[model samples]
Target: MNAARGGGSVENGIANFAPLAATVFLALVMLLPVGTGVANVMMPHFVLIATFYWLLRRPVLMPYGACAAIGFLLDLWLDVPLGLNMLMLLSTRLFILSQIKYLRGQTRLVQWLVFALFTLILYTLSWFAVALAKRDWLPVEPLFTQWLVTTLSYAPVALVIGRLRRVMV
Candidate 1:
């Protein structure tokens, strides 16, 4: 085992798990249905939430290129416009990093609240862009609903993630 600076160390065997887990998490998140909402099902936006986490805890781990790649993979996997998710992911990473100063050492509740607000903002911006260009509002409702579900999901995930940060980072 090699020790990272500041007393962090991991077995060579476990080093491979981080990216693998991210891949699986991305896969599962893309696959999972948001819920049974008749108007807004199939709306899980895990990439954004996952992006939120990486931006806060592992900026080096989940970089802009990684976000873009994941976004491309998501586009391929989900049949969406290429670069739609990529651009969103890129913008989101930038947004979070820009606001990174505000996230440090905050309570878990505060973190979640801030992220939820950020998610809502990103969703709105995306929807606004698409709506303006395509003259379609279909994405708006889904955006709101996905924010709700994603934020709700973020609470528990972040709690577990919060505990794991010291080890994961």
Candidate 2:
């Protein structure tokens, strides 16, 4: 049976995977050595942005399990304490879901502001976690720089993801 005849279609099935695929791609890209020195410290959290965008725009396609999986993968790749990224990503999803009603219909500026606020909170938590894991206090400058860069990069990342969502999902 065809989609018009009330059966699942191939395109629909593939589209359902787009969010996960895009997110994983972004996560991999985050591992690339694209910057130097301060630029490296300022590297935006592309995976975080992608996860947030997909969760906000299409929650059904980007669920908690997927978030956990992506985080786990990143933690392994980055050689951080296992589950650090998973915890952060899961926390982000939970926070966004709780505020979805308020976030869904807002303007881009409003959304960006909320994202910035959340990113600040998330990075703070991350800093604490890393410090605890290493049994020593870490420098705040890199975390602060990353938080600012990631927050600022949200708009463009969202725009690109939004366009991809329209075309693929």
Highest lDDT, which number? 2
| Residue 104 C-alpha lDDT in model 1 | 72
Which residue pairs in candidate 2 collide? none
**Least accurate 10 contiguous residues by lDDT in model 2:** 34-43
Candidate 2 yields a Cα-based lDDT of 0.89
Q: Clash number for model 2?
A: 0
Q: What overall lDDT goes with each candidate model? A: 0.71, 0.89
Alpha carbon deviation, residue 50, candidate 2 (Å): 0.6
lDDT of 1 by residue, 113-132 (tens): 99888778777876776676
Query: Candidate 2 versus the native: TM-score?
Result: 0.93
Error of 2 at 74 (Å): 0.4
Candidate 2 per-residue C-alpha lDDT over 1-169 given as tens digits, one digit per residue, 9 for 90 to 100: 5878989888989989998999998887888888677654546889899988888988888888999999999999989889988988899899888999999999989989988998898889888989998999999988888898899889998999899889985
